[model samples]
Target: MPQPTPLPAAWPALPTELDGVAVTPADRARYPYLSSSYMRVGTPDLILMARDVDDAAAAVGYAAGLRAAVGQVPFSVRSGGHGISGASTNDGGVVLDLSALNRVEVLGADLVRVQAGAIWGDVAAELSGHGLVITSGNMGDTGVGGLATAGGIGYFVRAHGLTLDLIRRATIVTADGAVHVVDAEHEPDLFWALRGGGTQAGVVVDLDLEARRIGEDDVVVIHQASQQIVDDLPGYVHAWGDLMRGAPREFTSFLMLQRLPDGRHLSVARNVWADTDIAAAQPAVSDFARLAPLVQHDASLMPYSGIVPTPRSPKVGQQHIQMRDALVDVADRALGERVAEALRHDVASLVELRSLGGIVADLPAPATAFGHRHQEVLVSLWAQPRGIAAIDRAWEPVEAVASGVYSAYTSDTRARQAELAWPGETGRRLRAISERVDPALLFDAGLTLRASAE
Candidate 1:
């Protein structure tokens, strides 16, 4: 086994209050498991496993103190350690690990309180009994803090809005070690910034979310189908887009395409109907199946929790690929052509198209920091981590037609991506808020408003 690395000479001493929760590089067994994330490998000098809001505040205060003394220090706050950009972990930095703070509680008939460290799957399981569900990411392991604060585009995105839209209140620890429980009525600016501005505003410890009631059975219909694109890839893409554009608000679908070595594209689609009513689901599901010749197809009814089952596995950087995504108001033949071009250029190993625009568009753009409420589709690409220049070069076609970027889904943190993530007036407001709440940029991770300003 490799030996533990030493901390930087200038690294500040750990606060005595945090010693019980701190994990340094010296702990071989535990340190190795906590040092990395789902998407990238890291070797953080210290990992503070914050057990509560107080511990979270202390960690942030400690990092801020170090930055004040040394001018600059790498600091990151990690919830589930599943951020696609892998910004949650860093080499030779301080990681505020909130995994131990995971907790889910139902506050009322429709209100649920969840700790930042809790995974979406666990939240679903807890809320299942209540006959309520909150729209979160498709994956079970995604952290509540990261997705709820950024923007959650998932299986129910069309019926519900983004995860950020569900947040009624949040408990955040700002850079100055100040804990604030913010909502639309209290500290509204910070609350707005927290919803869609990534983590630049502060470290969110927990959130009070509004959950939507489902049927008595509390199940949704899932239709999964796959086909081999032997020819006319663009046509298939266009038809798929057209179908979704006309589909009912109850229908939401995600299509994944990957090029096989045999020079054919393998297309897989996951379609969901927010309700289990077969009368409303069958026609839309059939329309999607008719988009292409399917090699396999199946439909099932399952609890929302069934799809996002958590593995609770160790973080070892298992996903080794770079990802980029954009939100477009229209999914047309032109968009399909551009996606085909990107795939032909070997820019991505996998490309995904998720249908949006239902209740998601019901909210006005300026309602929260997560503008782009009018977008109709979310397109994402995944490729081997072959470096950013090459990926960006081949991604130009798709990016040209994009109206916005989802920062949480992309690994690119360049100024351009940041600008796309928060554009025009939205960018301006977010930058102002970040400067006020986190002037020292202690919680700077992923695509941020400060990066956009610069």
Candidate 2:
């Protein structure tokens, strides 16, 4: 039998509470599965699978102790293991895995208790039976902790606002290992920070969300449209944006635009009607179909759960692409031209534009940590990870026109990115709270406000 990898000499000992769930490299059976996230591969020195809130607290305390004794340690807090920023895993550090703490409980007609480790798809499925829906990301496999803590731009964002907006209460373990139950009434500062401040505030174990009533049975109309643009990509993009912005709150859409190798452009839109009213949704759906030259169009009224079904897949960092995003107030011709120009650089593989307005815009900017409520569109640039410089150059212009940044969609976690995600007053408040709660900056993974604060 092979011996387990020995712990580093300078590292602090693991807490006894975490011994049963800890996986070192020598535990080859479980180590591989827990070592990587959706966008990046990692070889963590220790993976602590927290069984409960107490275990989660213990993990934080252990990591904090290590940081105090040995200086900066790469500590990551992972929920579902599917993090686009790739901050959930790290090389030669500690990963506090909360996958085992997943639980979805319906406490009331509109209130639901969801563990951090629960996937958005599973939460949607559980709520579907009760005719309740919570707006989440496009992927069902995304962890609730990551999305709810960040900003959730989903198909119903125009109708329901962000996932963070629905957070009624949360249980978190801060850097000091103190378990805090925060809500609008209690620990208001931490509650404000927890909603959209990422993991910098602490490791959230679970959240109680106020789910929205979708209808009689969580049913909605899903329209998928495809267009082939042979010329003038900017014109078509602008038209699609116009239609989406003018559409009613009941409608939301996501557009993926890419240039094919044959010198043509492929524009696909996934449109969602927040209700089962087919007649009311057809007009906007029709407008989307006519954007370029429609090649395919499909619309069906189905349960919202069907749109975000949970698929069990292991995370091996299969998605190794470089991603950058910007939030803009309008998708006018100028923005469209900028997107086209970026693609022409041959560095970006594609660009995604997600509609965000309607009810989302109704929220006051200071309502939460995600203060870019007025931005109507989120533009994301994707590349093959050829070189950071090339992609950065390609995305520079687009970022110049953007009003804000969505941390979840971005891969760059540097201080620059942090400055964009939490800019000005928001950055100042989050920095103050972080300093008070985590003075040593032990929980400094993802977009670090501490670095930006400096």
Candidate 3:
């Protein structure tokens, strides 16, 4: 494989000052540490922390001019730095960090504008005060920039749809350094692309999202654990899937596997239902509780904000972490056995099965860059760094059992994973859009761009 050329060191045509821009070694060090996701291996050549959108635009313009002059274009703008593929960092190029541009303004009780640098936690907190909330990622630390653009999924997804569904408008800085406001009425094509397009299109400075008022006090969250893997696991999954198929719009669930302190394994299932009839939703989740004695159950009504707890960062010292994902319609008994068998090999290995139906599957393909609109469930397999050989040995059995990959859960560098996520025509369309917006192929480093284009 050929190595990518490094970006130039000096800028000949850049202005002396860029609207209160700051570029120091400390700033560069901070940029390297800006990644929020688990993958943190690269460092940017230069860091330009912009104070505002003008400053951001100016910084981008300077980088573009320098790229044209030195025949080396930069990768992309990074906000919240959650890209799992390391797209936020460049080998020897400028990284336009938007973290400093965090700002939020409520247009009214029903709408607000958020800077790309802000995380979903801050947004939710600010909106909750006004009795309004926007659909956002389940993880509070996830940035609104990447999540909204990549089709935000969360606890509220069963009701309000993806995060992009709430977006009313956005201010984007195009590759040509021109700033444009996009919405359903204006620049509709660009708006369509931005919904689920990822960061390949451009840098979104600000996003205007529609907000809704729900019964925050009516939220019900339940967490239960299964002690043993029984033959009834598949039956429980099928029953849950059937319930979800007919579930009210206000209910959502996440089923995960966690390692117990005694070196034993347990399956933890969490369900959040906001309907008026809590007793009715209980029967849907009762089988799992029956399968194993309840470990900890919190089924009482609480505030909507209370349901979304603070997200914990990835554990340290776990290098060489590899994740595999799949979307399945039915959880087979044989597959469950294989998963249990794989878990016996290592302590850190986990199988996270998230129920996906209702609003998630009803959305149109072009609604956002999220292509898996028809997937019923998303299964993610993750392994920590025991060693490269250990990861290979543990992941092989799980990989063999999975049917397909989920785009969001899989790493961005895996092109094969993207192919499994998007399949044929959908993958081609996303690639074509990437080429059109980024003709010079500047944003191709860490993202799952077309391998042939590279």
Candidate 4:
């Protein structure tokens, strides 16, 4: 009898019969769970859990072949497994699990190379020794590949631009079954689309990211339990947006109103930055506190990684029903109040507004696939409204003052979801590029513009 490879301390021993890739029903008993999105439930016919870049390429080849045989097939790749949209998994397709390839290596003091499957929390610990930081999602458990390609918005948001902005290079497995290393100069078109459009072109195996040097001692967090949006929900965005614009680039804030487990809703505000001299930074922090009716405010120096909430393991298969309206807007006060009122009365969910602009808007919209660069605030509403009627009412005010929407926040497979995510000229650009790079259409275009948007 041959022996199976000893499992990692965290994972169970793999069945000897199961190699790197596992098929359904065969591996189903031990490894049925895979993905973190709540929008859909699917049992993939094939699950290519790769052990390395070579394995990932082989999996991509298999999916490409299957997709080629049957037109418009569903195939997906999951990394940190925290994809908010249901695109992480498919009804009956392949899921290329990249977690096994997790590796983090510092190229030097200021650049880091990360495998696609690794989570940011692991990367943070790896980079902490170098006194370096990279802008990523607010959650430490976020996957590097998904967030990086989808345009990461994080604690260091206003301080640096989007995460994709710092990408130095990447190794992606194209449909031709070969790993192509791309950067600004190499395969620049594919690289440009990958910056914010996601895996429509290929599966990124690993990436080189530019790291900003900052130590644990330089990080600071400003927390305040200020006015509840409930008091003046309509007045929230304009006040917060005005504050975000006037505040120093060193500071970033998130305005949220969420329901507690006790069924009470409280508005919350949080600010983070990495800097020396708290006293020098005090006056600017005070400006944000006075924006709404102040309740409490505190400042403390912490680690760069400390800005993200403590990493929590996601519960697989435990789907939370949520409808999100993620938009970019200047946030008209009167319109914001209407949105707030709608949220307060109809939805039992939370609403979040993150500060945008600063370096994020400095680049031209054509610089990357992310086009809503002009907007100063991100309005995200997570709710389960009564029905189409209630949802329509809740979205009206938000859409009124918004420039455009982000596909990541909403997972519904609408007929024109692509059109909504990237509208007009931007959508046309993505469509044309997608056709050029992904002639097979094997890659999922859920996050891009609709192809038939004539």
User: Backbone clashes in each candidate structure, one number apiece?
Assistant: 0, 0, 2, 1
Worst lDDT run of 10 residues, candidate 2, spans 218-227
| Candidate 3 segments whose C-alpha is farther than 4 A from its true place | 1-14, 26-38, 71-76, 216-236, 259-264, 275-280, 285-288, 311-320, 332-338, 341-348, 386-405, 451-454
**lDDT of each structure?**
0.85, 0.85, 0.63, 0.69
lDDT of 3 at 220: 31
Whole-model alpha-carbon lDDT for candidate 1: 0.85
lDDT at 149 for candidate 2?
Answer: 94
Instruction: Assess the local accuracy of residue 277 in candidate 1 as a C-alpha lDDT between 0 and 100.
Output: 81
Stretches off by above 4 angstroms in model 4 are 1-19, 35-40, 70-72, 216-230, 258-265, 294-296, 310-315, 385-389, 413-417, 451-454
- Give the range of the ten consecutive residues with the poorest summed lDDT in model 1: 221-230
Q: Assess the local accuracy of residue 414 in candidate 4 as a C-alpha lDDT between 0 and 100.
A: 58
lDDT of 4 at 5: 38
Per-model root-mean-square deviation over C-alphas: 2.9, 2.1, 5.3, 5.2
Give the clashing pairs for model 3: 196-368, 196-369
Record all residue pairs in model 1 with backbone atoms less than 3 Å apart, i.e. clashing.
none
> Top lDDT: which candidate number?
2
TM-score of each: 0.95, 0.96, 0.83, 0.87
Top-down TM-score ranking: 2, 1, 4, 3
Ranking by lDDT: 2, 1, 4, 3
Model 4: how far residue 228 lies from native, Å:
4.3
lDDT (C-alpha) at residue 97 in model 2: 95
Better of 1 and 3 by TM-score: 1
**In candidate 4, what are the lDDT values of residues 1-454, reduced to their tens digit?**
6544332233333334345466553554545565334345556655667888878877777667665655555778788777776677776566778877789998876889999888888887778767778888677887888888878888778888888889989998876668888999998877877777777667888999998877443333443335542455556566766777777777778777764445444677767754555775687677766666655556676666676754546536455655555556565576467456556545536678888888888888778766668778777777673565566576666656566666556644454545555666666676677787667777763554533232
Candidate 1 residue spans exceeding 4 A from truth: 1-9, 217-220, 228-230, 261-263, 452-454
